[model samples]
Target: MEESFMPKVSVIIPVFNVESYLAECLDSVIGQSFYDMEIICIDDCSTDNSLNILMAYAHRDSRVIILRNDCNRGLAFTRNVGLERASGDYILFVDSDDYIVKDLVGITINEIDSVDMVCFNYKKKDEIWNSGDEHIFKMKRGIYEAQEFFVDTVNNNSVVHSAWSKLYKREFLMQEDIRFITGILYEDIVFHFLCMMKAHKISCIPEQLYLYRVRNDSIMTKRVESKNITDYFRIACFIGQFYLEHSFDTRLEKAIEQYIQTVYHSFICNYRRYELANHGYILKEAIAEKRFAKIFGIVSGIENYYGRVQKKIEENIGLIKDGNSILVYGAGDIAKEVIETLNYYDVILEGVAVSDKSGNRKSLFGNKVREITEYLYKRDESLVILAVTYKFYPEIKLKLSELGFNHYLEIF
Candidate 1:
């Protein structure tokens, strides 16, 4: 490939310290069915052998371009660097730890006709590829006009904020000035939201083109630190501010409200995760600011949900003291309230059961937090409280049933 030669698509891969999976990731892209593309791998000062692997690939293939950062810049900056060097008409992001199907580029390029962006589905991979069963981005092939994309996505709560799952037109992104925000953990949320808001023609494909490797070290899989909570609040404030600056059509009002409601639920549910005393004050200040009116409107109703959750928790107090090992099935806000209410009646909580211990606290309410699967042998002896959101009820119920857990209290 010559300097003057331009590719049809640019695959921007921001590499950090992923040495073990780099070759597989690179191989998947290099062996893509589509040939007219450039693989831009920006090494973010990886301390491991990732750079050597990247160098080997770059030596073998002319299309595999390698760029290195002076320091260990984060994923957002590394991606922006790749964006600056990308010489393709279209763009696609790929994480160094993940890989895509052979026809990913070919199929997405075929569907990208006259559209600003093309989003496809992805399957989750751990030890083996598992059915993610996620509702996000699970949609039929269709094109959406200007605010229609955002409205539909938010209405269905199907916001796949990962940049890796989409193919974007370089011209549209540059015209809209859509770039990743630096120094943010959830940069994709802001970038994807901007694209959804500005894009005139966005297409959704039902094909599962990408393989998302679920690792314990991944940012989203790590424990919910104070920074994570603050970053989430920052994203909410940013979305609210963006809404204030741009006058969206009235048709999107309900959709935007629904989106805010979802974010608010998480914010309130993770309130106990904030470490600093001023964290509540930060939210209060955001509420006071008119720019965050959309966000804080739901924030105003935070206490209302508590009453209902508390009432539900109290109703299950009698069954808790029936001589079985008591455990809470969730570690969220409602779980905290359940524990507190149970403690009010001097009920002893044996443990807390979580889907995964990676993203949750090691201990909740002074009880050791373990995976729900760990209690399969003790299912008969444990009395569990399913304290989770309404949206997750069906999935949790099914999981409990599958694990042979019969005695459990359900909280909406």
Candidate 2:
């Protein structure tokens, strides 16, 4: 097909009250090098200037099509509305607040070929970041068995939770009658989970391209109404139940257990959400009936296990106390984990190396933070702990070698 005659890709964005960043989000899509596409901006009855801003953009760009929710329909219903009106070969849902990479549309479509879904990496940011590599969340990619892509997403990666992060073949979704549930808070997740399960082929690339803005108020991450919390539990159970109803893959079961471990670890013991009691009761029932015993076996006492690991890392700091200095390789969660544990164990935290991403040279946990280069020049006998995510291990190790950082170790 000629460029102008090519089927337009419908980029669906569900709008709410994101006045501050709506223009940036729209600019990225409008400026996309890909010309044969339409922007479907759904105004979900915002109480702010969001709808007006979207209208302004629509007036400026003929390709921008605007839709309105009769009332404040949830994200799922908004997306379903976009899906219903999308007259394109492919459809993609992007959050009203988040913006895509500059080459996101072109690169994804080029690499997508004829796959049912094109998955790309996304980076989370409390502030805007130009380099996508600093805060990336990676997931498994490849062809999946012909189940609804949404079905596999529940235990692995909730597709609904990430509607804006991937591209969809619109025909595949509409032909399968995949639509989001109305009057629900987490409709995207439920609908996406249902959609992906029926997908035949999926592709993933590791390029960290999507920027997810974490608003300071964190309202998006905050707890919803009591009724919404109850709805969440029902949705959670329905997701797990759907996965169990489908197949006999032991690998899938093991993966499911890991997700449960993470959930129980966060909601049950750690974050200490008031949700603990109700969920804890269900957990106890599961243990009593031995229903998800395998999950329990894998996750039981994970807290204590982490505590022991922290203890061991502190013990390793014995070297630093014995006439050796220490360098911590990461400045984020894991580095903080090790630094805090060492201080708890009475090991003095001498120097902290913020990850090379920013080449930061300031205190993150305490007044001890400095650049790795600065730390190296300041001290000779320092042993560094490669306290970073496992995925970054190889590159960080190589970076260390280039910088002559030989005296280091990893927990794994």
Candidate 3:
């Protein structure tokens, strides 16, 4: 490509107290083989030494621009600063704590055709910065069109409403007035949908080339309040109306229909302990108004109409005896729920077992956390509560039986 023929991309990064991983993040953005882009770092009045480090970088390279916020505005506002100051044909958001693969820019840039956004698979990293992931995807027709991208991605299990993992056209983004929601968490969820709705052509590339670092201090991973759900649901409900008014398409509608359930369920599950005074009212309104789908998520995944069946099983499990010594079958959030419900009934949990081909095995519940393979062989045992959904039942049952387990049962 000739000098001016190459499309200019403005890579925007928002930083706030990500001092520990900022260096690595900067390296990736600055090290991009495609040098036509500018790396703009917006510091959201970080109290940490993040600004100092960014300034140090600015001194070294003219391409690295550092913008300081007058005060501690939230992520939405900081990202908008990046958006407002961006000077390229396309805009890309990279989180300060996350780093891109060496080939990420080179590959994503090739996808600048008939696409609103181009996305690649991402790897999860721990606070220590170690990477973790199973399967990654690469898809096309995920590039420019918003609603098409959302529908296809959700159906194929690849859509994640995160900003750090995608590239977007500046004109499309600006035209949509799609800025991150100020002060509120879960901005990506709503914003992504809106963008997709406004997109013309879409595409995707399935490559696990981005590293997403999981930090305890990050707002998303923190224990959320009941109001968090209220806020998220409210935005999602509005977006649903936005879609309806636009009259997008069946695929996008189906995608949102299934998605609303998971969103509501997440709200309910995250705030399971404290009753959201208006949780029921908000969800009922969302559902009754035909704003969202009834989510019946199976304990593990948001898939295959399993959420409904899982809800039915959960209703019955609540009626079971609490005094029973429970050995929960799964080690996920839902399994945690079974454990919690059992504890609510004053039942003693014996152990937890997890079976997944693509995950690291670690103890979650206080019960002697072990793999089903390891836990079932123990001669002295209690109820092996199959806390997992029916989909995984065959695999779990086969594994437990192979270990000569006879007391295996379901929480319901």
Candidate 4:
């Protein structure tokens, strides 16, 4: 290729022990309709065949560039190495296991010329499940001012705080000196937040082009350790300090506050009592400073709201008749919690019903997993408990009712 024909997008993939899915990921990138792209795979001292796979691809494709770490530095440092080595006009970070749509680069490149970053949507899947075309929310496609984008995304919860689904201008990242927090598990939390703050213009597209594979080995799926709990607070403190250092408008300040509050709420929900006790002082100090009053107020309101919801659910337990079969809809983390709560109460269940798009699973929570359509066909007079997030509750309720299911409850 000539110098003018250089790759427009430099895809930085940080590879670890992902031999099982590496080929699929590489194939997706190499087969993209937009072929003017360089694939930079950073091998973080993998013990598996991940490095060899990258080497093989490099031998066959001139666009493949293989880099290695001397030792096993974590994802943050490895990504930093990729950022330093990237040569394209725009940079995209792709996890080794995930794949993207064939025209993702072409679509993003066409829309990203006047924006600092382009944020797109993604689908979350399991080993067998693939969330095809179903997105959480539909966002308008246009260029947005930085504050407007932050309000629509981080504040409204339309976008996830992840780097993978976004395309960044190489010059913007370099000029802002944006880098990940080394030796931290949830480094993306801070990095993504800072990018939104620094970007002058951001473009939002509704296309679900990225496929995020949910696996047990991933850090987010793993049991929450004390380190993970502390990392949340660490990032909160970092963001709080950054806010103090910079002068932002009231709207942006409120958005940042909401973002930090969400992170703190997640920490409280996931951590044990002992872990909370250990880090409770940080919360107390933040409150004392009065800088996070909005966060505290939001957290307090959420607690009260959830408490009322829990009370309602408890009082309505009598609605479930004795010996009535129960079918839980959704097979996500919240669904698992619902199943466990039912098990604790010794409630018998018929089975778990999942959407057709999620593929099929043998079982969930020791109950057989059946498709929603199949379960609907069985005239079991079952009470279907929709165990999904609050945002999807209304749509799910409407769908179940349309399918002729009379008895259903949504556990937000």
How many backbone clashes does every candidate have?
0, 13, 27, 0
Per-residue lDDT of 303 in model 2: 43
Q: Tens digits of per-residue lDDT for model 4 on 1-412?
A: 2457587889999999999999999999999999889899999999999999998999899899999999999999999999999889999999998999898998998889899999898876665323232446446778888767877776545657789979999999999999999987889989988898889999888888899887768766676666786677678778877877888788888888877766665554444322456666655554464565555463443353223334444555777545377888887655665675565456778888876635444566456667788876653587888877789877777777778777877665
- Per-residue lDDT of model 3, residues 238-274, tens digit only: 6656655665456766787766655655555544445
Cα error, residue 365 of model 3, in Å, equals 11
What is the model-wide C-alpha lDDT for candidate 1? Answer: 0.79
**What is the overall TM-score of model 4 with all chains considered together?**
0.75
Candidate 4 lDDT score at position 211: 93
Give TM-scores for every candidate, taking all chains together and pairing residue i with residue i: 0.76, 0.65, 0.76, 0.75
* Pick by TM-score: 1 or 2, better one: 1
lDDT measured at residue 177 in model 3 versus the true structure, 0 to 100:
84
Q: Candidate 1, residue 310: CA error in Å?
A: 10
Model 4 spans with C-alpha error above 4 angstroms: 1-5, 128-133, 273-294, 297-412
Angstrom error of the Cα, residue 160, model 1: value is: 0.9
lDDT of 2 by residue, 187-225 (tens): 555665565566777776667668777664433555444
lDDT-based ranking: 1, 4, 3, 2
- Whole-model Cα lDDT of every candidate shown, in order: 0.79, 0.65, 0.69, 0.77
Question: In model 4, what is the error at residue 330, expressed in angstroms?
Answer: 10
Model 2 TM: 0.65
- Residue-level lDDT of model 1, residues 97-177, one tens digit each, is 999999999998888888999999887665322324232353568887847877776765567889998999999988988
